[model samples]
Target: FSGTGTNMFKEEGAQQGFSSVTKSIGFSTDSITFGTIENGHLLLFETSSSRKLGEGRDCAYRCQDLESGRELALKMYKITNPDQRRAIFHDLYAQRSQVGKHERIVSYERVIESENTIFVLMELLNGKDLFDVICTEALTEEKARVLFRQLLEGVQHLHRKQVIHCDIKPENAMLLGSLEDGTANLKLIDFGCSCFKEFEADSRGCVVYDSYMPPEHVADSKLSPSVPTDMWRLGCTLYIMLVQRPPFHNDAQTQAGLAARQAGQLFRVPEYEALSPEARGLIEQLICGDPSKRPTCDEALNHPWLGLA
Candidate 1:
């Protein structure tokens, strides 16, 4: 909700779509603690830290697990209506339960539902998301490849489990570890728009930016949203990671993206020519209009660009 990104190429840090990423790395000391052990449920926030960690439909707070004493982030959804929330995630709880946890997916520890809120307890991430990295840090194709490969691994896991992360983008993926001093690993996060089946997943559930969606999303004919949507999103994400801009702008530009997607002209940006052919080729294939032509995560991982061989 915070991003007001423009469709122009001049402004790099401008956020043109939905602001789903947690851009705040630091928290404010102003804090309040709300919860009790007497109620058999308690979430404590230390005064040394800020209560709210991120922004969006839900807010994350630094909290501690009473039993384990381990630190964790508590994602609180204010809307208490289960049905409304389900309309956004489509059996959100059930689907996530099926996906469970993975090396690349954020691990959920507990789910607590109260009369007015839904609280999800997850492992605390120690690094910035891909969006922030692209904005603030220096990125190289090698580093992008490192993160993209892990991202593909995570999505591959979801697809293998018959899940499609409709909201695949730079914002939805985060890097683990101290980015300044070490090689950071990627962990896919934010399952608010994730789904169990391609057809069952609703675009409404995906707070998708116009540019991130595939051409199929706009077609009027009979078509159910599918995992291929995720592939298109991946292409957009990868392109943004390397070029510091989404391949498609939003609204009008997205319409242009459809044409480019059909023509295989997605790599027309000036910055693209400087990139290695393998990298550009993979991006072109991923952003192609035909879903059948797009490579699966398995095939993408083995692509010459990723250099798995």
Candidate 2:
């Protein structure tokens, strides 16, 4: 198995023993009946070369809907073992439960689980994540305002639905459409870590990105989740957009120690002194030591930093 699968299978009319087909570049897959399509085949991308779209544990591939002829992204998970298969089932349940078609969130198509793997079909986005875009290109304060406002809008939507994105970060914000022009747009992706928590109530910070966690997150295990936690991460994200680096004690060498230090201390970006006072003010309130003092998504949207006040 060369990581990326060709999905070798016994052809429909073979002797069922000795298989000798060597199609490496691309492979045909049997159609699946799910979501709004019946007998729809998610065709492996037709490429001149073999490739996979995403990296790490979760692998995504370009796919097509045979019924509507619409292109989609297929996030595939190989069921290597029984444990992995059970875990995939949990992930699918969480993903489908918390996610749907929203203007700010990535549009979820459907999930198809076969004997060997599970496929998550989603809308195909053509752009880079916010972290990469921020680092590579110089983001003016005004541009940051536009993007951060959109981010807050997404947060607002999630909050309205009582959903908390446990892993909210710039890396999870996918930028697309009008990015090259004066306006900017984004869609929040990766809902696997999202959860439905009671509004203004605490929840277990079970799934989280340590770097983006608020100071309270480290002080008291699971006592600092729900809405405030997401607001804190949004503060971190906005800081990265403007300063082009993570806020607070980010250069602490190791992530574990960094998270520990972040709970106790907070640092102001030296270069951020050049940014607008409103911007600094918002970040300060968002990263306030007390999670209870942090603003809600709607409150953040009204912050003077984004000029929506």
* lDDT leader: 1
Name the runs in model 1 displaced over 4 angstroms: 1-50, 79-84, 87-100, 178-182, 198-209, 250-257
List TM-scores for all candidates, in order: 0.76, 0.76
In candidate 1, what are the lDDT values of residues 1-309, reduced to their tens digit? 232223331121111221122333464344323232334544433312355677865556887654567778776554445645653233345334555478898877655433343445677887788899899865778888888899999999988887778889888788887544656788988776666664453444553545676776665324555678788889889899888886765441356656765665664677777889899888988988888889999999999989933
| Cα TM-score of candidate 1 | 0.76
Candidate 2 on 189-249: residue-level lDDT in tens? Answer: 8765666553223346344757676656565665645788788788888888888877765
How does residue 208 of candidate 2 score in lDDT? 70
Relative to the true structure, how large is the alpha-carbon lDDT of every model?
0.66, 0.65
The parts of candidate 2 lying over 4 Å away from their true place are 1-49, 80-91, 198-205, 250-266
